[model samples]
Target chain A: MIQFDQVTKRYSGGVEALKNLSFSIDSGEMVFLAGHSGAGKSTLLKLISGLERATSGSVMVSGHNLSKLRGSQLPFVRQHIGVVFQDHKILFDRNVFDNVMLPLDIIGFDRREAARRVRAALDKVGLLGKEKVMPIRLSGGEQQRLCIARAVVHRPAILIADEPSANLDRAYALDIMELFKSFHQVGVTVLISAHDETLMEDYGRRILRLKEGQFTA
Target chain B: MKHYLFLHWQSARTALAKILRQPVGSLLSLAMLSIAMALPLSLYLTVMSIQDWVGKLTQTPQITLFMEQSAETADIAAVSSALKTHPRVKGYTFISKKQALTDLEKRNGLNGLTEGLDGNPLPDAFVVTPASLEPKQLELLQKELSGLPMVEEAQFDASWAKRLYGMVDLGKHLTVFLALALSVALVLITHNTIRMQILARRDEIEVSKLIGATDSFIRRPFLYHALWQGLLAGLVAWGLTAWLIAVANPAIAEFAQLYNERVELRGLSPLELALVLGCAVLLATLGARLAADHHLRRVSAN
Candidate 1:
């Protein structure tokens, strides 16, 4: 569960990314954050993942309070909330399998078990056949799928993506949405920020619209 | 426990693979590490071996008494009887003026060198091995014998023994300073290497951070890198020191033969080897930890 109570995030340059925002995400709800560029969508996801602390309000992630938690405790919270970055953040040096295998390695999963999970996550994203290929050789859509595979490899309770389908074609975009939907079906709380409104329309999940730094009508 | 070992083994392999990918750079770094480590180790061995050899010998300080050339047989006999009765004197050998010249000639094989001399220039001497090697006691005995009739001078080479100990002390200090300086240098080398590695793999680090990798997990491969480097450097240094000693021992033995003794120069003991390797690993690991931790903080803060 993720809860934000009047959370306000102010960057170092005095730009308010989030202002007096309050919201709650239940354990198994799939929500979409809708806004154009500069609409605090990324900041919201960052807060949920414990990547950034709120400037003035409480941000609670899965019973762990982000504001009061120590630095060492942040990783434990993050381990339960997988984050897929907007830029894809896929390691270009490693093959697809190693890229996805990272999260399990961090949590010290059993070796054979981790291998099975890596291949399983790869199979889920339809990248199983390309497990040995370097991420640089993968197409943009396939690379995006690679990021999703890495995010879900550890089977996190909450999965959040920022602009997951921004540059992909319409079909691939829908396919990405279906992937998140499938995870939500398995009782994984999913929150995603996207490039536009129509991409999230068919899902019928709650859409929180933001303008500037506050939620809009 | 099995899982922990596997993780460590994986980390170590990862580190080794990274090093192997750039053979020349890694070899250069290892070469630098070994030379830095070898210098002090070799010096310590040398000083320790010399000290050990010197310690095994007698510590008894001998006092030599030179008699007047004009002294009669009766005066020499009187001095000898006096030394025999002295409680501080353990034993004494009296070399006459004639015997001293002949012995010197025989030792030098210079049968004709003394013929040109008008008479024997060497003095008769008594070498007294004192019962006590104490400096004060030896000094007192020397002074008492110097005042004896027909005794021109009494001498003991106490300063030679003092000089040997002084040199050993100085060698130890030099070795310690070198070791300390080299250890710091090695730490800094490892820090810089790991810092560059972190920068080069910034994407991995940042992605790992977002995906829930802990600070220690991110830091593991780099620590293993340094640990392996340190261990390799230590082993190479030991090998280099051992090789250098083997080459030097023959010359050292030959020199000892000149002194009518045999010396087999010893290398570092097994315990010292373990200690050197342990220190190397510890220092390198510390360097890597500091670098990785500093960068982790800056990366996470952003």
Candidate 2:
């Protein structure tokens, strides 16, 4: 479960990115964040992922408050929450399989176990047969799927992504959403932010709309 | 513990693989480090060998005590007794006037000259070798021996002994300063190398951080990379030092032969070579840790 109470994120130059926002989502729930550009969608997801500290108030993920967490403790929190970056954050220097194996390697998984998990993750994202292919040869939608595979390889408890469907065609974007839906079905808490209202509404999931860093009615 | 060791080995292999993939760059780095290391190491070895040669050359300083013509055997025995009881005197040899005359007659150039002499003009002498070569102590011992019964004069050749000691002291101090300065240079070089590596792999590192990797997790391979670099540099420096000594040994031997002496420059021993490798690895790893931690902290802060 994740909870945010009176959260306000003010950057160094004094631009308020999040303003007194408060919300809670139960475990195993799929939630959508819908807002236009500069609507604090990325900032909100970053807070949930432990990538940024809230200037004021509290962010609670899995019963631990993020603001009060120590620097060393932050990684442990991140290990449980997998994040698919907005720009796809895929390493092009290696094959698709090695890219996904990075997370398991971080956790120090043994070779046999890591290989199994990597193949499983690749299978989930339909990249199992393309294991040896470098990321440059991957199409944009396939690359997006590769990012998803890498994010979920460690079997994180919470999976979050920001603007995952932005650059994709309607068909490919819908396919990517279905993949997140599959992870959410297995009792993984899923949170996604997208500006496409019609696309997000099709899932019939709860949507939190933000306007100028604050939620709208 | 088993898993930990396996992960460490894995990191080491990955680090080595990266270096092997870039042979030219890795060799360039190794060349820079080994040459820097060899400079002080070679100087240190040369200084030690020179001191060793100097010690052998002037191992004993003998003060000669020439006796008066009228001194009898009793006077010589008294001088011998005093030298035996003296704490500063290592040992002494006696030469009666008759024995001195016979030795002079047997000499290569002075054989005929001694035949023209009358009544063995050479004086009886005692050659006293002191245990301590300290100039003040030698002068004091010479003065005391000269004041003894029937002793005409006492003196020792101290200039050569004094100059050798001074040179040895200077060489030792010079090597110390050189070693300290070179160690710092090696560390900074390792730091810059690791910094470039971190910057080149920024994408991989950032992604590692984004998905649950600890700062240490990301730094392990880089530290291992530095460890390999340090180890190779140390080993190469040892080889280079040995090769240099081999090249210089003939010249050193020829010089020694000119003085009817034989001195061989000793290269680093196995234990000393091990020490160099260990130090190189330690400093390189330390540099890597600083470089990696600094970059990681900055990335996490933003």
Candidate 3:
């Protein structure tokens, strides 16, 4: 579960990235964060992920207040929330399996168990056959899929994807959306940030719209 | 705690693998660090060897005594007899005034001038050798000898001894100063290298942090990279020092031979080698930490 109670984030340069924004999502629910560029979508996600502190109000993920969480506790909160980026974020030096295994590795998963989960996650993303392949050798669609597999590899309770379909083709983008739909069907909460109205129309999920640092849904 | 350590090791291993992917850069950094560390370490070893040699050479039985020209044979015999009875006095040679003049004439080629002199001008002297030439005991013996009735002056051949001791003191201070300067330079170089690595991998690092990688998780690989760099550099430094000693050994031996001595150059003992390794590890870890902390903070802040 994620909750934001009138959160505001002001930068030192006098720019307000988020202003008194308030929102909440129930467990196992999939939601879309719709906004134009600089509409505070990224800021909202960052606050939810405990990556940034709210300037004035409170943001809580899984009952841990983001503003009150100490530096040492941020990692524990992060291990429960899977995040994906538009750019795939795969470590180019490692193979597909290793990249997917990263989150598990960070959490100190058992070696044999980590290997099994990594294989299962790759299989889920339709990347099982390409486990040993380097990320650079994969196609753009495959790389993005690998990124998805990496995000879900740890079986996180909630998944956050910031512009997950930004750079992919229509077909690839649709495939990614379907992957998120599958994850949501399996009782995993999902939140995605996107400006593609066409894609949103196809998915038919609840959309939270933002304009000029204020949520307007 | 076991879990933390295992994760740390895994992180370090992953980092090392990544570094191995770029062998050229890693080797270059290692070589540079090794050379930087080797110079001062070699100097330190050389100073230690020289100190040991001086300690050995100064432990010889040698003393000097001056006498008055007015001293009679009876007074001279009395002084010699008294020195002979002392427990520490190993041997004493009485150099009579006539014998001193004859030795001087032989050295200066003035035999005819010495024959024309009415009487022997040189005073009686005692060349005393003590049983033990240990510094403290020798000083005590010199004091006792100087207190004798007929002896004009009692001195030790400690001029060269003083010079050797002074050099040891100077070497110690110089080693400390040089090690400090070199260590600072080493840290800076490693910091710059790590900073460059962070900048090159900026996107990866940012994404890692965004995706819930802890600072320590992100920092682990950089720390490992530093540790490896330090270890490799330490190995190279050790090799460099060994090579330098090999080349300089003959020259040092020649100098020692001229002084009628058999001095050997010493290498790093096991403890010293461990110290060198430890130093390298420390510098690399510090450098990595600085670079990682600085860049990670910047990335997380943004």
> All models: lDDT?
0.90, 0.89, 0.86
What i-RMS does each candidate reach, in Å?
Answer: 1.7, 1.8, 2.4
Give lDDT tens digits, candidate 1, residues B1-302: 88778888889998989888999988988898899999999999998988877665537677899999898899999999999999999999999888999998988889987879999999889999998877788889889999999999998766576778889899999999999999999999989888988899887888888877788889999999999999999999999999999999999999999987777669878899999999999999999999998886777624
Candidate 3 stretches with Cα past 4 Å from truth are A10-19, A35-39, A91-95, A132-137, A167-171, A201-205, A211-217, B15-23, B66-75, B84-125, B129-153
- Evaluated at residue B260, the lDDT of candidate 2 is 72
lDDT of 3 by residue, A1-217 (tens): 8988989999889899998988899999999999898998888888887877899998889988878989778878888988887556678877998899778877789999999999999999899999999999999889888988989999999999989998888988988899999999999999999987789877778899999999785
| Best-performing candidate as measured by DockQ | 1
| Model 2 Cα lDDT, one tens digit per residue, A6-97 | 99999899999999999999999999999999999999998988889999999999999999999788888988888888999899999999
Model number with the top TM-score: 1
Error (Å) of candidate 1 at residue B35 is 0.7
Models 1 onward score TM values of: 0.94, 0.90, 0.84
Q: Categorize the docking of model 1.
A: medium
Proportion of native contacts kept per candidate: 0.78, 0.78, 0.41
- The per-residue C-alpha lDDT of model 3 at residue B123 equals 78
Which residue ranges in model 2 land beyond 4 Å of their true spot? B1-4, B56-60, B66-90, B95-124, B130-139, B149-153, B157-159, B300-302
Predictions ranked by DockQ, top down?
A: 1, 2, 3
Q: After superposition, how far is residue B36 of candidate 3 from its true place, in Å?
A: 2.4
lDDT of 2: 0.89
Q: Candidate 1's interface RMSD, please? A: 1.7
- DockQ values, each candidate: 0.70, 0.69, 0.44
